[model samples]
Target chain A: MKIRESSALILPPYFFLTVFFILPVLIILILSFTHNRDWSQGITLKNYLLILDPLYLKVLIRSLIFAVLATLGSLLIGLPMAYYISFSNPKRKILLTLLVLVPFWTNFLVRIFAWFTILGRQGLINSFLLWSGIINEPLQLLHTSGAVVLGLVYGEIPFMILPIIAAMDRMDISLLEAATNLGANRFMVFKKLVLPLASPGIIAGSIFVFIPALGSFVVPDILGGRDSFMIGNTIKNQFMTVRDWSFGSSLSIILMVLVLLGVSAYLRQGRDQSMTLGEYL
Target chain B: MSHRDATSNVGFGQGKSVSIVTISGLVFLYLPIFILIVYSFNDSRFSASWNGFSFKWYKIMWHDGPLWTAIKNTLIIATANTLVSTFLGTLAALALSRHRYRFMGVYHKILHMPIVIPDVVQAVSLLMLFAFFHFTLGLVSVILAHASFSISFVALVVMAKLSNLDRRLEEAAMDLGANRFQVLTQVILPNIWPGILAGGLLAFTLSIDDFVITFFTSGVGSTTLPLKIYSMIKFGITPEINAISTVLVLFSTLAVSSIHLFDREKK
Candidate 1:
């Protein structure tokens, strides 16, 4: 309880975070404005300017598109499931929730790798179709935009489901019965009552899905072709392969700014209401 | 009444559709994982074909030196990261939850920042930081990077538990002539031990599963399971990966289920 004691408690984590986490981010932010890979050269706007080029701009746009689509895909699949789980009996509710979350426990790269096996030319779908005599040749299911989107959506679906289910669990069911009694149709009850109440979860879920999907390198890297390049891939390339630290740092800063903006909006919205990590999990 | 009939009809229809969606959603979630697990036992070297079930891949994995080394590195990093982060995080959580301070708001924001930032950004930043300091990228760097994000997770979990804790118990301990350290060790810690355990497990899970940050920070001879798996997958899919994935998935499932069951019991 003493100030000195508390400070002692806090100082270790604070120092660790400052050195490993905070300083690195600060370095990147500084590096972003510089022209040279290392800090020896003078600072310039060239990195930011380079981002404005049509090629990089297009990759950024594609990243946004993939994220938005993945968010929508997960919502479409996850919302109804969450709704069902919310209304289920307690035993069934726990079982169903666990079932939904089990895949999420698997390693992320392994899950993406599973998709490679499922969508590859000689993979599951192709094998099934070929056995059924529906096609003579294997379809090009892998290394396409669809493959990338599927990977993103599959990877992020649990994030969507968990929060939405939490929201639905907190919802007042009596309102639904009352709406039904007041002559509202099922669709009307859902649209006017349920959807509005679950909006917080939906928003939270969307943020969870969208942010990761936007910045994902693994999904695109393993599942996508050259044409499916995303901003994450470009940034990784800039740093690792090209060894252009300044450009990589610039791209990263831009992505971070965008993500922080989204997070700030979410925080502002979340301020009015209380949600717990238990529910989010 | 006709109204009753109509409502029942709607309920029946909704039930039917909900069941359909729920069943299909479960299938969608589990199908890929199930397939991957199943193929791990396939005799075929290529994962795509069913060359009859055998444990050859698993056997190969057992004898694989590099695979074992990677697993060793992963376990080492995960264990070290878990212990260090959990300790640091518990302290931070205690500080934030137990007392109000001048810089609490700023400290809270700082804690949450790492959680929100994408892994790629975090990875590159840490990588750059190491470069700046001329620190070699290796297990130590990986541990530091993982602990950075993991501390936040541990703090969040522990703080949630801390906030829900009944403060009267601590007050009673104090009133009973128990000193701060005595109350902390005997009363406070005993109560929050579950949270700390859960936080530690969660940190362990995240640390082991982490690829992006580890990928960036790992130097030669520091290939963790994920980095190793990534390289294998890039080279091409092999049943060896399937075997590895299966084991990891099973371990993770056990870890996560225990976390859930622990929390459920507490509730």
Candidate 2:
């Protein structure tokens, strides 16, 4: 009786998602294979094959590289912060976490724009360098790969930190105490106890950061120079600038497939191994 | 439990470690915001110097008509999206909670696709769909796109609250001759008001801050605040941009703090 009642409530959300979201994505998959312009022109593999050119291929590889780096950077910063917050007093925890989330709450463009003012040639960093006589010329901080990475790491760290903090909060303090009592030193305790407990959060955060980082167009567009084009920028340009919807759709499909495969592999490994590191990002 | 270390070391060492870690974490999280706020009032264009405080930017931004239009559009979209999504999501949550299905796992997973899939992909797909259907790119498309994701989030939050809800109360209402609709409105909703409010606020924030999806779905003459900011950045930096950002940040801060206070009071 309860089960029947529950399904009735679930039905609306399911129906909406199926019709609006699932249908569109599935249509995209089908569209990528069909004719470019006219739907009536029928099926063709040319769109899929078209994205395999070296130019598109290069963007794909670059995006992967950036995603990997971004995931690792966020993880490194987020994991330590999560660990620290985990051991903090409960009273201070929420307040401290808010600091992480406040930036996320603000308009995303505003935050990125703030970076331009800080990093642009005539911006703060350059002004400081010029004043201090550190160099005769202002350092070129803007429109660089470094800036792109910095922007991404700045943007995504909150996402990484929050999940890990949630996972860490769920951890039992007694486990760490037990490890310490069992002749495990601090380093050993962290390695054997804390790290394992934090793995799920870290893994989840990594996936979250990695997937979006790979597909982000804004950061690279604003911060990256000519040579810094990522796959997202390419896809965006194709649709918006190049007016090549078919090619863009194909590129997006490939990206989706790659991300799906990567996540599946991670999850498969997760199921195979008893991951202690899952809880902390 | 203190076998070796004396009383002096027990709490102090751990406390010190935690303090250092916490301080460092706060620095990581808050330093950027601190810088942003500090620069907001600077007379100098750069953040490097302690430029004299000036409100010029605020004045300029206040006068910008396009920015005002963007804000209006944003409010319209956010409010409409929040209402529709919240209503639909609450209905779905109630249905899911009160009924059982053969494909529960599959159902839940599909609903969560919007959260997991990259935003860019979703934006492109939606653009293609809407464009193909000959839908205008203005208010209608943006609301539809925003509602799609908002519903998922709202459903998830409300469903969680629903799961923890005591069904006995609803049963008692029914036993007292109340119908399903009456019990839902009078009993279930009041109990889960917090969750519903929380979800609604989230949807509002997300819709206002959405850039990529809104960018794709947004038609001509429907410029939102984020789009305005994009245009501003594309042109050049201005004090007006800072002013607008400050206002946005302030609103966000107020919203977030109120929610926190509410949660605390409940606790």
Give the per-residue lDDT digits (tens) of candidate 2, residues B109-223. 6666676677888888888888778888998889989988888788778888887789899888988999877988899999999888878988898899999899999998889
RMSD of candidate 2 to true structure, Å: 3.9
- Give DockQ for candidates 1 onward, in order: 0.48, 0.42
Candidate 2: regions farther than 4 A off: A5-11, A265-281, B1-25, B44-51, B167-179
In candidate 2, chain A reaches a TM of 0.88
Scoring only the A-chain of each prediction against the true A-chain gives TM-scores of 0.94, 0.88
Q: What lDDT score goes with residue A11 in model 2?
A: 58
> Please, what are the lDDT tens digits per residue for candidate 2 over residues A155-229?
787778887877666666667667767887766766787788877777778887888888888888888887778
Model 2: how far residue B24 lies from native, Å: 4.6
Query: Which digits, one per residue and each the tens of the lDDT, describe model 1 over residues A70-116?
Result: 99999988988888776665666778887777777778999898886
How many backbone clashes are present in model 1?
A: 0
